[model samples]
Target: MAKIAYILLCHKDPEAIIQQAEQLTAAGDFMSIHFDASAKSESFAMIRDALEDNPNVTFAHKRIKCGWGEWSLVQATLYAIEAAIADFPRATHFYMLSGDCMAVKTAEYAHQFLDDNETDFIESFDFFESDWIKIGMKEERLIYRHFFNERTHKSLFYWAIELQKRLGFKRRIPGDVQVQIGSQWWCLRRRTIESILDFIRSRKDVIRFFRTTWIPDETFFQTLVRHLVPENEIDTRTLTFLMFTDYGMPVTFHNDHYDLLLSQDFLFARKISPDAKTLKARLGKLYSSRGIDFQISNEGRSLYKFLATQGRAGRRFGMRFWETESSLGRERELMIVVCKKWHVAKRLTDQIRQETEIPAIDFIFDEDNTALPDLGGIQSSLAKRARHRRSLMRMLFEYFESDRLIVCMDPSNLDLMHDFFSDRSMTRLLRIECDFTDDYLIGHARRIGLAGDRTSQLTLERLLPTIRNDINHEADRIRDAGFSRHFRIRQSDSTETNATKLVEFLSLPYETALKLAQTRQLFDD
Candidate 1:
């Protein structure tokens, strides 16, 4: 087998990294590891012991201690590549891989690809163009120095960013380097890797410029390479395969991505750790549409059994309804819009309806039915004088088979739903909240007083923080029933923000949500 240098950046997950190393080293590849300096010494020792006396393996003495989006990532790669060059002088290709990534292909196939495309530098694309430009992520990612990794510190960093955003301020991009980004994983010829390291050492200013930039590992080599290597030498197609979340997180592949892995010509796939998450991801993908035969591995079966045993006592709701609820391209996504009272629900519902033009089924419990506004729809519309909250929801679910759906509940009346209709599992909840003072003055109590409920005076008492408790209780209930993710919209939020929040909850695209907010009538802010 041809000598390939695999540069693995390991933080935690030493076991998984060991498996990753084992997969490639069998092909007689030289593996160079740079363990995160912050990692437990015992774990690092364990990783070293696992690959002990493997003449093909080398460890970098200069370990870097950095978290996500730090200069340490670049340093670690540099150190690993430097070590690999010194130890495995004969290695033809330098491959950048992560601790979470596993080799999907045998070494023979990988070696063949390397042999065929010897000069092609894998994954060369202009990061500043296309999607990043449209989404406007460059301002946040490229300009800002997001060095802090701790929770509180990161929160403060974002808080300062928000203040800066309001004040119309921009962070300085350190040097005169053409800034761009790309997928961090790549297989490059030995010369390209050496050129990158050389450029870094020679142009300390360029390296220093990228240090304060977010996730510089993705950009540093990519930006510098175009200057060093010819455009014809760069092959934009990456050998590493990945699927990302709405946020750019790589979806952890398990058995579900087995077919995808086989279908691709890629050599590596990332973030495959822990059988449970991978199983769940596979399950989510498999069950994302109409019934397909999916075999459950022992680990998968165990995961399902464990999930079933979790949450509060509830009837086993099959995944069929969930699939229908979660399926993409459905005419309308359903949102269970629960608020404290009639006026509050109307206000929040208006924010959603006006911004997104999505039909909202409001659970308005007006005794005289005069105050509640009419809504439009087929046999399922709640636009006319509303029924009691529970009955409306019961009737809605009876006929509603998950098409453009939302439910509204007042937390004060959660007792009406104790063990009844409301407890039936919803895919997610979007709580609509109002200002507490306004809940008494402009919302529940005021409306109750107008409607002449004998308990109008007590309504304010019940309604105080009633929204939060009810929302929290409902959140707990749904999560207990295994519908864990939820969102919120407060009175303080603008209509557009609320619309985006609701759209996200319903899994609608950001563009579609944005169009709704922009084109739709009566947008808030």
Candidate 2:
């Protein structure tokens, strides 16, 4: 039989750990637990008694009092692994889990997923460099300094500094890569576990270094692995399961630690609290009725549902392929000039008339003039903005009808156009910050120019070259207008506007506004 070992580092939650053990044992997996020595003796006794009937449960004898921000937890974990190795030599994998954490996927499917990925699926949480942790540390330091003496302050500061050094310290491992140390709840193959243990045993200096460090359990293993394996082989984003909170802190469910697990498509389901007696009955019934087997994980089901809905919506929207046939023997290239204001549209039309002799430029404004009321109020202002947005969208759709390349001068206009014609292939001259590269806009135009000969789906990759070309052309025209050094294309996207308007809108400081205007002009030029 294939065996998997679970290393449980219990703190204050003995009951929760016992309940988790029950579930693990019932799932037909071998289990081993290491209780923190700092825990009350009565609690440990209760835990031992609860597991006495279970043949798979083996309790460790060593006791180590683990303080917050100390190496005690790592020591306890190492001891547990050493015991497990000696007892279960045939075990295939080792999974490090907390008593508070619940399994979001069924045991069998979770195992299979791990096997397929050739990695242990541990939750990354991504809180290492988050603002929350930064703020928390600052606040904690302040409190300690105000209340404690020099010796006490030194001890606290050392813990904090050491933690920062270990966890947040950047190290260039093999492959010329760099990454910070991570958490303790990781998965490892049996061989990897043995290798890690052997390496630790050989490195007496490393163990000595960890003795004074804060939360060495989180960093020690990660640091060792990064040094040993190729950086790419270490799966950092293995955290598929998430316990949603208002912030980073975990929320309790049913008076126990039950974190909600979110699926890949953002669908969420509650993980049953370990201590909840009604879990088995409630989950069993729900699982059976929903036809969710251990093999069909929550994420798998969510992905299937997401894809089905997207396909249905795509069909409903009349998603069509791009016309690839070039305009053979056609005199004009399809040109779409999208703009917000009628004056700007007219100006672009005039520019196109002067620059491109081969293709006639067509301009369309989809503004709903009727929606604007003569009366002055918030409603009227909103109506005017809506009309302006709509007008830009209409201009975007018009690009598909023409054989010419498209041009959008205003960033806002481009955004509205992209949103409206998301399903269609249209070229625009604006680049949003979210775009990966400057050529996104240029490529769109190039693809449309080539579309006369080929038929295919228009993607971001196809449109970038056209975007760059249009930007360059626009820059040349601006330079010719004699405002070359004073004005430049900071961004062609509709999100930015004239320096005077942007400065006022952003409420930037005077000096900052001037600097921004300077950069904005550089792009405009």
Tens-digit lDDT string for candidate 1 (170-199): 766645666666778878888887888777
Alpha-carbon TM-score of each model against the true structure: 0.55, 0.44
Q: TM-score for model 2?
A: 0.44
lDDT of 2 by residue, 382-448 (tens): 3444444333233222322233443333433344444333323322232212222544343444544
Q: Pick the TM-score winner.
A: 1
Runs of candidate 2 with Cα error greater than 4 angstroms are 120-179, 238-240, 244-247, 253-525
- Model 2 weakest 10-residue run by lDDT: 320-329
Stretches of candidate 1 exceeding 4 Å from the true structure:
132-136, 149-152, 162-176, 245-249, 256-260, 276-525
RMSD of each: 15.9, 21.7
True-structure lDDT of candidate 2: 0.46
For model 2, state the Cα shift of residue 491 in Å. Answer: 70
Angstrom error of the Cα, residue 170, model 1: value is 4.5
